[model samples]
Target: MAEKLESIELALFERLIDVGKLLERRADRATREHTGIKYTQYEVLIRLRNAGGEIRMTELANKLVSTPSALTYQVSQLEKAALVERVVAPGDDRGVLARITPAGRQLLREVSQAQNDMIRDAAVAPLDREQVEAAYAALGALQRHLRGEETGGILPDQAPPEDTH
Candidate 1:
């Protein structure tokens, strides 16, 4: 049983790495051709949008799987495009928050739809919806486990964080 479990773990790790590489390649190609923004930037916009348009820079960085400096660079670019603005956090002058502008929301809507369509066409269309749901559930459980939470239940307030990798 121990050997079998190790084999399963190794295979899962290999498949996950392969999937990450393939998705990154495909997403980069699609975004370059259609959105004019990198996949990671779009992910940042989505994260901001989902957080009700603004969130602390550190919080956003955590959600984005990015470093503060890297996120700062991305946010700077977005700010120049008028897609996002950085504001000193109220009451905490030292903290910064990234706010998605109306333009950012509009762009997110357009690009998100296109990106979803592209992903569905290229990936989801090949999978049974039930299979996809099963995968989502299993991955969510794994995510919670990896985060050091107990297995089997995710608290209402402990919903999985968005993966912007």
Candidate 2:
């Protein structure tokens, strides 16, 4: 029983990693073909758009699962392309905010349409609605678990907080 359980656990974990890799590869290819921007850049634009068109740079980095320096570089590149702008945070000389511009919003609309078409046609066409819902539930639970949410399975990454002495 123990060996069988361990085998199932390993298989599930490995398959999860593979699924992520495959999805990323497909997203990158789709972005390049449809939007001419890297997948990560489109993701940043979407994040900014969702955050009311502007957010603090540190917050953006956290949302993007990226480092501050890396996000700064990406934002600088986007600024050069006239897609985004950075302003010093109000009354905070050390803080910066990244705002998507008109051009950025337009780009997002185009890219989002393209991505929607691709996902609808290429990704979701074959899946039954119930299958898709189940997959989403499983993945969402995993995400919550990793973030230490009470709703999930409390995986290793969700270790209990240490009490201050």
Candidate 3:
């Protein structure tokens, strides 16, 4: 009985990861089709926009769960495309901030409807209201626990403070 229970728990964990990857794959394909940019880049634009169109580089990395080097590469690409710009953080000579450009905002606006439709079809349409709510609650709890209460908040735009250590 213990072995059976363990198997069930393992399956749940695996399925959660699988579903997340599957969704990312689908979103990536759709984002590329609509914007000529990878979903990863698009996500950076989204995060910057959510954070009032600018955020510290370190904080953005934390929000994306990405390495600074990887984000630097992405930001460089976006900068070349004129979709984002790197600016010196106010009052901090050593700190940089990533800000979404008007073009980035326009791109997001242009693709907004398609992205919404794709998400609704792929993630929401199949689930009933009750299932959606239950999943949201469960995932919220899991995200908070995994990300820590200090880092994860009720809204995605609520960024944690930069790590000083």
Candidate 4:
């Protein structure tokens, strides 16, 4: 009985990872077909726009689950494309911020419908309403735990508290 339960748990975890990768690949392809930018760059632009058009580089990196160097490279590429710009954060001369350009916002606007359609077709269409709700609730719980917020999750827009040490 214990072995059966363990196998079920393992299967669930593996399936979740597999589905996430599969969906990401599909989304990447759809995004690239609709826009010239790669999905990673598109995501950077989207994150910038969602964060009121600008956010500190470190914060952005954390939000992206990416490294600072990786984000710097992406921001540089976006800079060349005129999609995003890096600027000194106000009141913090040492801090850098990533700001979306007008072009970035325009690109997002143009691709919104296509992105939505892709999500609906690839993700939502396969599942019934109840299954969707259950998955959402389960994933939400997992996400909170992973983010170290099972007790009380920090809002995505809020900055994490600074470490005293």
Point to the candidate with the largest lDDT. Answer: 3
Q: Each candidate's lDDT (Cα)?
A: 0.77, 0.75, 0.84, 0.81
lDDT of 4 by residue, 1-165 (tens): 455568889999899999989988998999999997888898897777667778899988987889999999999999999989888987999999888888887898799889889989998999999998887788879878887533212332353422121
lDDT of 3 by residue, 1-165 (tens): 455568888999999999999999999999999999999999998888777788899999988999999999999999999999998988999999998888887898799898888889888999999999898888888878988633322233254322221
Q: Candidate 2 on 1-165: residue-level lDDT in tens? A: 455568888999999899778777888899879767777887777777766678899989987779999998888888888888998998999998898888887786677667777767655777999988887787888767775432322322242432121
Top of the candidates by TM-score: 3
What overall lDDT, based on C-alpha atoms, would model 3 receive against the true structure? 0.84
Please give each candidate's TM-score: 0.83, 0.80, 0.87, 0.85
Cα RMSDs of all predictions? 6.1, 9.5, 5.3, 6.4
Q: After superposition, how far is residue 121 of candidate 2 from its true place, in Å?
A: 4.1
Against the true structure, candidate 4 reaches a TM-score of: 0.85
Give stretches of model 3 more than 4 Å off.
1-5, 149-165
Evaluation by TM-score, superior candidate among 1 and 3 = 3
State, as a TM-score between 0 and 1, how close model 1 is to the true structure.
0.83
